[model samples]
Target: MDSTRTNKLLELLQTIGLQELNSSKLLSLVDEALIHVSAGRSKNFERLEFLGDAVLRLAATEFIDQQYPNLPVGRCSSLRAQLVSDRWLAQLGEQLQLESFLVLGPKALGDAAAQATLQADATEALIGAIYSGSGNNLEPIHHWLTPHWQQTTADVLARPHLFNGKTMLQEWSQAEGLGLPNYTTTEQSSRHGDPERFKSRVEVGSRLSANGFGRSRKEAEQNAATEAVQRLQDVGSEINSESPNNTPH
Candidate 1:
């Protein structure tokens, strides 16, 4: 790496709270992480992203185990899924302003719909770079990611349905012999990145249905499922309240 690019990489590390990091080898790894495949480089973020995927899962597992020791294994798995989700990684990239440092080809640069995916891939690669740069230590990864995980955990605990709505709804429907929830999605807008670009409707038998909107089809479907789950819960509450067992008798 040239002196100019090296200095820039150092600056980025500082921005990420990795201050006084002057190791050239680590800096090179970080540089590799920021390179997109479209850049036509012989080396890109692909390998690092793969490594980071594993590293991230392990780190998230450790975090959950340490923070919620009594949590059930199934719940721990669910929480880890959210923590290591591509959406979460993209959000992390946005927080770190990683787009500014990314090296993209003209095709990638002009593709707005793919921006979030690119960010997610690059962020995972960055995580891999950090872990590799630290001589395969988890300390730096934990030090950087623990706070984010804490905040995510709090949010998820407060509104658990929001994170795993589709799964929860599926389980509930099947358990009640209602079969699977059916989902139908439609594109609501042509503009990329629009929060309501897609609309989704979820139907469970003939008893319940809900609608939701989001930037992507999956998100819209999930949101619709979340609303459906909430409605089912409300109905159950009402049923229990009106039951003879809970009445004046």
Candidate 2:
């Protein structure tokens, strides 16, 4: 990489609080990943991406464990999935405006829309690069990602009932012999990037279980399912409380 490019990358890293970096391994990988084409040199971030995928998962798990020692395995798994998901990574990459420094080839440069798998891949590769540079250490990764991780964990835990609502609701329905839940979505706004772009209603049996709004159809439906799951949990709790199974066996 050129001196100007190296300096720019360093500046970006510093902006995100990676102040005392020990390794340049991460930066090299970042450069490789951002450059869409490297004809002669095979220094792409693909390998780093593979390594980062595992490292990110491990570091996220460690973060969750330290923050929530009493949290169950199932719950931990759910939280970890969200933390390491492509959507989450892409969101972070976009927030940092990583694409502004990307060195894309002619074809890849044409479609400059900053969404989807590319940014996510880059983010993971970045983690891998950091890991490789830091001599397989996780301290720097944790330090850089701690704030984002905490916020993400908080947002997810706050909506604890919303975790995998669709799957949970489906299982609950099947167990209760109520068949599959039906969902209907309607577009509230046709404009681009509207938060309340779609509204969804979920039905169990002949009754409307719940309704929710989201940026996309899937999100709206999931939100509705979360509502249903919350209702179900409340009802179940109440039922158990009232059941008279003789006094404290």
Number of the top lDDT candidate: 1
lDDT by residue (tens digit), candidate 1, 1-249: 788887788888887777654587789899999999989999999999999999999999998888777777877888888899878999999998889989999988997877788888999999999999889988888988998988787777667677888888887778778899999999988866666789999998997899998778988998999898788777662211110111110
- Quote model 1's TM-score: 0.82
Clashing pairs in 1: none
Window of ten residues with lowest summed lDDT in model 1: 240-249
**Candidate 1 regions with alpha-carbon error over 4 angstroms:** 171-177, 184-200, 211-220, 230-249
Cα displacement (angstroms), candidate 2, residue 59, comes to: 0.6
Residue-level lDDT for 13 in candidate 2:
75
| Deviation in Å, model 1, residue 31 alpha carbon | 0.4
lDDT of each: 0.84, 0.73
How many residue pairs in model 2 have overlapping backbones?
A: 0
Q: Give all candidate RMSDs, comma-separated.
A: 6.8, 7.4
The TM-scores, one per candidate, come to: 0.82, 0.70
Model 2 bad stretches (over 4 Å): 22-26, 37-41, 112-114, 161-163, 171-176, 180-249
